[model samples]
Target: MTTVHQLSSPWRHDFPALNTKVHDKPLVYLDTAATAQTPLSVIRRMNDFYQHEYANVHRGIHQLSMTATENMEQVRQQVAGYINAPDAQNIVFTKGTTEAINLVAQTFVKNQLKPGDEIIVTEMEHHANLVPWQMMAQAGQLTIKVWPVTPSGELEVSDLKALITDRTKFLAVTHVSNVLGTINPVRDYIQLARQHQIAVLVDGAQAVLHQQTDVQDLDCDFYVFSAHKLYGPTGTGVLYVKPGRYEQMPPWEGGGAMIKKVILPTGTTYNHPPLCFEAGTPNIAGILGLGAAIDYIRNIGIDVIRSHEDNILRYCLEQLQHIGDVEIYGTPKTRAGTIAFNLIPHHAYDVGTFFDHYGVAIRTGHHCAMPLIEKLGQNSVCRASFGMYTDQQDIDCFIAAIHHIKALLD
Candidate 1:
């Protein structure tokens, strides 16, 4: 019951996709947790790069290469600064969060764990965070431990005491639950993991736009996030390790930019941290887009965006709660951007499709976390997530659409 006013997102105009119309209705994009619409600034930046500054970085001595190299490296520094990392050198570019986590799982965790070692993860984790460990466990013969979720769909970090045994080698957790919008108390779990000398990886794909991230403050061993989630281009991601942690991991992939010297007869000496981890020519345009995205977030201010999103979250929840037949999932103690629910008799896909025909976009089904949806006693749930460009009008349109769909279905 916070004050409700005609609050519109000031930056909505910056995203041209929001202006799209379907069947004469304006697009009400509410699937941001899945993927947000790219801002014009980011689009323009990528377009400009391809038009003018396109070149392979780290391997060329020419002017275009140098410029591209400088800009790409500057993005690394920008990402480090954005997350408050101790140094930009610790950041490695990957395809996306999925690759970043898999990089760690493949390079760092795989080498360190023995047959009896364990890796701890929460029930609320996205499949990107969960499946890699499952695969690793099968490959390395390691035990995968689950940190159970409360009824409200939050990790019971207090339960960490029992899970982190002497055999625990690593722990991976998501900063925010994509399904529940629950913000886990990551600091508490990280601290506990540190006590047991277990390395931790935090997946921040759903977190970057919701609030400011300080990896230094969180003291996590490693952090991974996707650029597209933060209004950047796709095919670009960040994997940040602590100052000295990168040395512990050998290169995950091998290709052009990852090595310093390649002797056909002898062998190859790899590049240092960031470059060593980034194999091949890399996604030059996407990296530049990520830089522009960081610039966009800086100019908008994450704190300002967060306050606006929090207000919208409260407003949307209050409105949805009014529907007696609607059953919302994951009532977290504290939530940020996403919400999932089911309107009793209607299938989630039916609700999503009906809304889509009317120009509203929402995510339906397990959301890549089938175990969690099943744990909550459902096969599927509809999720509507928010972003910087989402506003009251979008929510109102969604609500109105939902009521119409409910009536039609009933």
Candidate 2:
């Protein structure tokens, strides 16, 4: 592992929020797992759209609308390339990862699920992946089976094999555990499900920004992730549907943009796959910002970003372990971008509140992974997640804050 001093991020200056202050102290943001601070390029691109090119996409023949439509469609292609999807037509835009998963649950799985049909989801899934399938199970009289995680926070392939029966129809799992920071073997999971003819949807909200995501390589039926986690604007996400999978899914939402023809009393004809899934006036400015975000990552290179984050995570883990009182969770074989832990004899919320006073921003609580927390025998934990811009200085600040908290609370 590289020393923290030898691993400063060259891209720190690109994110303006690093200079932000709280209680007159420079903000040490370590909460990328929740949402990353937007880079200047993404901000400028969104501002440029609102200032000069505001228009409803795919609705008007006017110049502004045409320009917006063209730019949005280009971004659709960019997203497809980002994940190495089979085709641009396979990408569908949504509010975020939560909606993307829900979109599939409602359209693709809902209609196909029969009573006694089983859906397999891991215990480490964030609520976004778990709740949607639970709702589907309730509505369709399906069974939700849990693929248990080990105490070290890894899913055993044998456990998955046992859970797969002839009745299993779908598998919804996370690419990485947002709480445990464990990078699951999604490829293995997908391959197993493929053999059984079970559809798979990978919740990629925590994986995309930290690693290069190739949907085709993963060979998943559906892959979902949020743009905000990748330094783009919020309220924008991508759902990569396999070529065969999209052809079978009906429109989850119906409106003006998704429909080709609607004869009121007669019938209705829908547009193509991507458009059919995207209803109403989409987030044009946010989509443009997402495009800029993709360009920004490409310019820096995902390999560079992943290496930087790896160093930061390693340094953070070492510091936390050295503290002696800090109880880290999930000693998985491979982890990335995030480290979750609890300061002994101190509540996670209290530690987080003290951290904020020192301008060290982190997330505390269940992290939308209540079941995982319960499985770990912890009610809540503090998470320090890294991004492309995280550097040694931020880690130092966070370490100093931890010492301060221990001194005051211990």
Candidate 3:
């Protein structure tokens, strides 16, 4: 087991809002999985870019434009390094994870999928990962196959062989479930997909915040994640396509930046994948802030963050387990910080609202995994997600609040 204090996060001080009090009490933030609190370093980096280096990238010959372009490209390189992508050219910035997934759906899947083709996804996927393929399957006259999750909150790979046939065109799944906190065995899944010659798209929105990812090692054809969940700003995320895949996939959108030349009399020529996909004026400041966030994580080390989170998760699980009338969800062997649970005789939203009264922030409702919630025999759940800065005190406060709420409700 890793020592928590030895792995103290150095970037904690960079998030100024953590020091602020809510309702005359120190705020207990437990919704990091939805969106992490941004560090001051990242905020300052973005502010500096807007204040001085602001300009439209990849367009003008002026000095400011060149500087902005250089900065934007530098961040791309940083993101490449952050995820251990083989080349920086594989990193394409977008609005967030949803857009990144849609990019793949529009560009690659749309072109490749056909009637009788099938796409494989898990039962625990978020709507972002689930809906795109559903729409694609509907339009292309394809079949959508879902892999089963065990009652113990683990993905059942026994059915995988049956699911992947010659008709399998693509496999899309989450690296870590946002609601269940179950870390899926993505490498094994990727290997299985490789055997069937099926391309895989792994949604890293939840995993990227906790796990140390190497896209090359995973060997997935494509990976997507949002920066906000990783302590960066909102409106910034990445889609990393393998070099081979990137070369084959076309641009999803048409705009000023995506074109190399336009012949009105004939046709239009498009730029290569990364540039071709980024259609309009990109989120320059958000991209810079994302780079700073990656820098912040590197300075602190991912291993350290993972260890700290695991410790806190274990403690929270133990504490919640001890509470009477409380039932926890997703008891996976190797879970992350996200925990979903409910109290008997109380609604999840009510519990969430009660916790809010004590300045404890958590997520409630279906958590954008309505299908999974139905599978779990519920409509909604209370979710508490931890970050690197989250410690034992936050968990204690949360547990105490739950106890108090339960008492009042009873």
What's the lDDT for all of these models?
A: 0.90, 0.91, 0.90
Backbone clashes in model 3, listed as residue pairs: 14-40
Q: What is the per-residue lDDT of model 2 for residues 63-140, given as tens digits with 9 covering 90 to 100?
A: 999999999999999999999997889899998999999999999998787899999999999999999999999999
> What is the TM-score of each predicted model, taking all chains together?
0.98, 0.99, 0.97
Best by lDDT: 2
Assess the local accuracy of residue 55 in candidate 2 as a C-alpha lDDT between 0 and 100: 94
The residue-level lDDT of candidate 3 at 45 comes to: 95
Candidate 1 backbone collisions, by pair: none
Q: How far off is model 3, as Cα RMSD?
A: 1.5
- What lDDT does model 2 reach? 0.91
Off by over 4 Å in 1: 3-6
| Regions of model 2 farther than 4 Å from truth | none
TM-score of model number 1? 0.98
Ranking by TM-score: 2, 1, 3
